[model samples]
Target: MIWKEILIRYGELSTKGRNKKDFINRLRANIRHLFSDIAPLEIVSERDRMHIKIENDEQYEVLMKKLPTVFGIQSFSPVAVCSKELDDMKKLSLIIMEQFKEQEITFKVEVRRSDKTFPLESHEIQREIGGHVLRNNPNISVQVKKPDVELRIEVRQDAIYMMAQIIQGAGGMPVGSNGKSLLMLSGGIDSPVAGYLLMKRGVRLEAIHFFSPPYTSDNSLEKVKVLANELTKFGANIRLHVIPFTEIQVLIKDRVPSNTIMTTTRRMMMRIADKLREEIGALGIVTGESLGQVASQTLESLTAINDVSNTPILRPLIAFDKLEIIDIAEQIGTYETSIQPFEDCCTIFTPANPKTKPKVEKVTYYESFTEFDELIERAVRNREVYKFPEVNQVKDKFEGLL
Candidate 1:
């Protein structure tokens, strides 16, 4: 009488050759984790497709809204199951076509018979269901080339499944399928977008933020937390490491030359991130550096900063233009929060004239005057970690009072 199941079709996982099963298993786990709160449901994953059965109407409505955001799914549809009888098929087909009774539309009926022992063939079943619906609804017409609406019916050993709508899914490999990385997340529009791009490619993320107190307010730290929480919707939980950078920033401003201070600051951040990456077992470091967007993102400047670490540096927005990055930021819902008037550590002691192209030898020579290894180690040791989709402890504290 109503839809009782959801059918999921695979996207890139089908072409993985021998690794298809592992990818499917990972996707199944991710879906289970995403829907852990919704109970009384069954998820059955097959070689070509997956099916989730739900008995409650409210839960079915929730699935419809959440299934589209899940990666690794090419498309999905709500399915109505019925007994294998000619009269039942006809009645269900008529009920499905009743929605378009008021408007003129072109429609087609497609059927797949997994059970070949059925009395009618695929074509015969299509004609039977198609004819029944055509006779009942005068506003509907048949167009085999490309119909406005397509009703797909599948026959199996257990029952018959019917679906009339197919919704598009977020197509990519599931998050955490590739590997884990450390993202240098700042309170900026581009870094959050960069983390999102890596997550789409199946990379699990742990974010690192540099907080300089007095120079950076508590609201700045909260802004970074908000960005990390926004990213959790696209993948698994993110562990955010907030490094104390006030000492390092003050030291750089005092010892390093004004023209090349930006380069030294960036290199220090990379060194800290690389150390944290090794401690946490992350394979690479991710940043939102767009080429030529600012002085520090140029080829020469990037090379000077990258010399501090041997880890693979991933810059997803390297070739992207500023407008392009902003467009993606808006699409993923992080644009508004990133535009808040809060200063990060990177902006506090910024020089009016920074080196757009500085040699690695010269920057390294300037940084050698100050002993940074001790401070770098100290910053990493005193870092604070926060987990995203943070649990609300305030509600628990007031439970007894209420």
Candidate 2:
């Protein structure tokens, strides 16, 4: 029988032991919801691994493209059919090997006979396949530890699966499994990476972008929108809030001390982010602030910023260096876009020697001169909100493709 299935590998979830079944069930439900439009795919649980099977091949391919974005799966393989017994498994392995027999390479048979009742054990089957392949094609070498190609045969209760490759998955717990946060997204290298990491941990994200258009150009705003679009590939459609930060920034520069301008602005930003988070049902706020990554990220400065946030502020990148953050940014396809020479509102103002540590009382003194609270309220109330849908925009929701 030729049927398509998705094999899922969990990471830290397996450590849950007795609680593993609960996680698996939740993961299955999440997967089903994400692929709701494609087909009715049932998730089959087997010990620590989970397999997804659909009625048709087209649905399998569609799910393959979508499931990699899912958080729980470490890697997946698309396999062909076989039987549980030794001879049928070897026949299928030989046929698959013949397709790649001539290449100058090494190969090994990896067997996971879940059913011990099968006549031969996993190691015995691996050796038998190695012997058969060597007998048919003398030039191929037998390398056990690691090989250029691994022909895997998994023996299950109902069927045997064979495949030559494994596809990498998004790798993390399922989204919503960790709860939700509002990410402070800037049109720069760091914040998107921060959001990506949060999502990897199964944290659902909504974004708040501070824009100083005219000072920060239309291209800068568009750059942020593009960045959000790129991130949607990982899952969960994002609702991005664009706020007019230019006015507030100018007020801070003029009213506050030059040394404290950056700190004061960050404090105001935290206050505004907290309000936005409360309105949107987010449990906390996320930032890309890494320790010693920048002047404003200093402990004293962060403390001043934190004072305004009654809600928890999560800095996922707090301990990571610039190089480490950049390395991951490159891996997740955001580095190229992030490194673009477009300035966002955060960098446009004149604060060459901003304060590394700021006092809350001093910032309060500066705010006394202007009605800053009113300005923040207006900015949040009149913010331009855009929602990027989770499903790909092949067509409009009702109209369909033309």
Candidate 3:
């Protein structure tokens, strides 16, 4: 056969004290779920690593797309399987090298013979394979330290495997290992990045987005939906809860002074998110609030927001600078979409001078203007839930809660 199998290297899963099997099993299921539509495969969870064997060669393209996004996978390689003989390995090494382009290649061969009695030691196998690769590909040279390609050869009881290139993965614990959280998703850059970082830490996420219609068009809501969909590529099944925020915004603006409007609005959003978090059994709530990024994100403003939600608030970008957060946003494919000029609830009706040092008591005073208990209940009742991959289309009931 031409393409033999895929080898998966585990990250933190390898260091677990007593729960390593649990992590491996979770990772196996994750990989299988990601690959289910793409291929029929068998997963072999070994002592320290995992192997994925595909049913047909046609699934290679699908694997290339899906494998890199599976969390907990440190790296993966498409390896060629050979017989447990040095000559068989040498022959396959050349074939692996043929896949390398005409550009100058500096190479090294690393051999791990797990079967102690197979005759040739690791170094001996490396030497024989390295020499043959040098002779056959005249333009290619060897670099003992950090070569262009580190060709790997592994000898085990069943077969000999060789591969040249390694693909890096998402590299966190598998999703679903950590308890669920509610991501306070926005059309802006930071929240999407926050969701990504949490997912990387194995926290399964259901996202909540605040949409103010007319003040915020359907276009604005759709932008956040697209952002959540992009996150699915990283292996998260996100549900974007689009909450009608127009009436809440108008209520705060009409009853409160401009300076406290932003803080009060944030507190309302937090209250609604907290209620939803409990309903969904989420352990905490996540937000995009960076320290002092906006008036409503100031230390005092944050305190005002936190006062409303008993659930733990997870601000993944709390300490990050804007550029640092943007860099991650760009890397995770959410940067361009976040920078789009569609206003979500947070941006519209922003007061010129929101309270930077808002007190819990002052925020509470203005919150009394509108008896918001009924409004919050209504917002939650009318919330539209868009579970990604399946709910690709945001329904026509976009004008609800108006």
Candidate 4:
């Protein structure tokens, strides 16, 4: 029988041993949810490997596209499965080698004999399959190290699978394995990468973006939503909160010193973010801040801003350099969307010569210049909420994002 399946490989989850079943089940659920629209016939997982069977050939490309974004998967491959016996595997190996038979190139046959009760050892099976493939096509030569084609045979208890290629996956802990956090997702390179890093560590996220509608266009808010959508591909759903921030920016500028506005603005943002954390039942608030990267990101500046924080603050990119953060942004598929010219609330209300060494007491004294508590409450109360789901946007809710 000609059977089509995709083989999935995982990384650190293999080390879980007795607890591995829980991790495997979580990863399996993540894969199923992310590819809910693709609709595979069944996802059969055993030991450290998973095999996804499809009913039609058309689902191949769709499944391939979704697999790369599913965390906990180290790699995957499309395969043709056959019976567990030796002759059946050799016959299948010969057919699998036909794709490379057209070109005169170096190749290797690798065998993973999991069931040792069979007649041949791993190297013996490789030699036998290699000889059989070469006899059918003289154009193929042998190479041990690296080759144009590496035909693989996996001997499992139930069946033997054959494939010639492997595709890389996102490679991280399953999202939701860890608790959730509130991501301060700005329309910039660092925040998205920060969210990506936290997601890699298994932290699920709900993002909050501040938008000044008249000062910043709806197009800019849409850009932020696009970045949020890019993140959901990494095995987590993002419920985005868009806050009306023009009033806050104007108040900070009107009542605060020009040099201290950046620090004061961030303090208010932290306050609002902390409130969001409590309201949404998040463990902490995460940001893209790097040390001395900007006026507000300085150690002293961060301390002053975080003074008003009621919840813990997590800055994953705190020590990362610009290029390092950019590298992760590109790797996680959010760099292009982040680089879009649409500006965000953070870019508004220019503060020339902003305070890099802001003190909490001084920031407190500055806030005393105006009554700001009512406005922070107003911003949070007027916020719009959106949930980006894994499938069926209408039923699962991707409000305002569609």
Candidate 5:
């Protein structure tokens, strides 16, 4: 009689088997957190399915728009709850058939009875529902194999659920489901894109940005925040840690040969980033480095930089070309913000003829001269932290709209 339920589907969680309960529990908690603002809705979990219910209809549309942006869900549908009796099911079927009259719709009834005592089998219920709907509305055809609208009916112990529409889900494992990584987020075209891809694959990311104030303007720092905000649309509300790198950068420029400056600076960044990663419990470090993209991204430079970090270094865009990465950047809505003219740490003190390939020994020798340990410790100590709001906060702001 009423559309009061939301059905959730999991693409990869199906494989979790015995440990599925933990994953489902985590997902349910996250969903509860996500919709914390919409008070009338309740989230429920079962052995095979997840259901979200609403005491009022007002919150449904808002949930429809927002839940698709969440990371853990594969797909969801807004469903009606009604009596399992044939007459009630037929009435609802006619309403659904009438609603989609404009399109050349091929719909079918998909039924499942958790309480097997229901007299009819799933297929028999499907056929019976199909006949009832056909009798009421003659225009819509029935396609058992491939239907534009699948009217799903579930006969539970206490209630019967039926729904006609399925909304596409974000379709990935949950962020933090995979573990944590420290992304080296520069306000650049590639790094945010790289960060987005890693986050898409269930990696919870915290960002590390090197800032050289007076060298890199405050506007540039703001740009990174803006970029992180945009990434929040994809469920990565990253904690950005800004490191002071002006002195270390200046020392690198002065002590290292001009051609080797980029390479030397990158290696130092790897060391500093690794230290911070350990301090913060990050399992690995992520970078925007793409193969052969620039001088410092050359194989030799990448190898030298990799040598410094004891933790795993994840370069999501390592194999992607500029065009390929840009396509993804545009798809994720970061391309526009990334193109803004804001300098990042790498642009500070850029050498005209930076080395395409520098030896590790040379980079090591340069580091040995200065108090490298002291500089890294100082930079980490002077770090700035930023956090984003939880789902409840989002609701607090948008409750009136709901």
Candidate 6:
């Protein structure tokens, strides 16, 4: 490949004034972590844009495939480095344009002369290079407004770079720049989609999954693990905390009134999640509770759940329709796995006639009969923690006897 560097443009990060450097540093760190398994790289972060110098075609190919998945990048270009000489610029421009040789292409030349001391002005360089390409290639025509192909040239202090394509990036602030949160991940379609949206907004995540054995099978737990692993593709590795919730779930089912059981159960989950959030130093709790999608997601039910904790409850898909949530789940590659036939704790014990407008006072009175504080503490203590995108310890166990 002729391109020697990948130019990255920061999208929302550019709007940050004094904190710009912090965001940029965080982005650079994320890029480094994302590409750690690949060859060593020289990632240069600048005031306006960042560049990853391409060492070979292999590195370029890998970068092109993976870079778009990273947040904070608005767009990127594969740039061909050239000398300051006009002849060198012209020759390289023709070489770059050869990709569109046979087709009739509307093209324009854009030049950014960062090195003001360069002899030619920005327009001068554009004209010189543009004139060269038109003279040589008969199929290429110049169009100023939204050209089909734009040959962008940047005359920087060290070297001049040129490219024809600007690929769109996953635009947002860098992950972890906003802060950290604990995602109340469930073995369902909506929770994974909720996690994706939060990560897109630069919130780092550690997931909490409730598990109830016998009531919920191992397959159900595996499904949640798969979802958490799938989510790691968007940003950094996620630590999935699996809480042993069988005792608490059973107590709620036996003690609470049948109609208001869902509300009480959800409140218990909130209390446990909030406790874990505090333990892990998370700022808030994230859930996939879309408004009115289920009995537990109604305004009254959400308010009842909210009363368990003072910490913020972030419901990213609160207003989204079911179809809208599914579309995002499909886009992020979690739909197929999430649709697997597995019964999670929430679904396994779903009430026959759950109260849509459950009274908080009534649910509170019913839950007061059960001693839940000790069970909640024990569940959090016996939780299983696994880091995603890494080999799970349970999966690595030797089953056959030696």
- Each model's number of backbone clashes? 0, 0, 0, 0, 0, 0
RMSD of each: 3.6, 4.3, 3.3, 3.7, 4.2, 3.2
Error of 1 at 133 (Å): 2.9
Q: Which residue pairs clash in candidate 5? A: none
294-373 in candidate 6: lDDT tens per residue? 99999999999999899989999999999999999998889987888788888867878899998888888999898999
Per-residue lDDT of candidate 4, residues 232-254 (tens digit):
98886899999898998888989
TM-score of each: 0.94, 0.87, 0.94, 0.89, 0.90, 0.94
| lDDT per residue as tens, model 1, 208-319 | 9999999998888888988998888774789999999999999999999999999999999999999999999999999999999999999999999999999999999999
Identify the runs in model 2 with alpha carbons over 4 angstroms from their true place. Answer: 1-3, 17-19, 33-37, 54-67, 84-88, 98-107, 114-124, 146-149, 390-402
Residue 349's C-alpha lDDT in candidate 2? 71
| Model 4 spans > 4 angstroms off | 1-3, 84-88, 101-106, 114-117, 137-140, 145-149, 389-402
- Least accurate 10 contiguous residues by lDDT in model 1: 393-402
Candidate 6: worst-modelled 10 consecutive residues by lDDT: 393-402
Q: After superposition, how far is residue 119 of candidate 4 from its true place, in Å?
A: 4.0
lDDT against the true structure, per candidate, is 0.90, 0.80, 0.85, 0.84, 0.80, 0.90
Please estimate how well model 3 matches the true structure, expressed as its whole-model Cα lDDT: 0.85
Check candidate 3 and list the clashing pairs.
Answer: none
lDDT computed for candidate 2? 0.80
TM-score of 3: 0.94
Report the number of backbone clashes for model 1.
0
Candidate 3 weakest ten by summed lDDT:
393-402
- Candidate 1 clashes between residue pairs 3 or more apart in a chain or in different chains: none
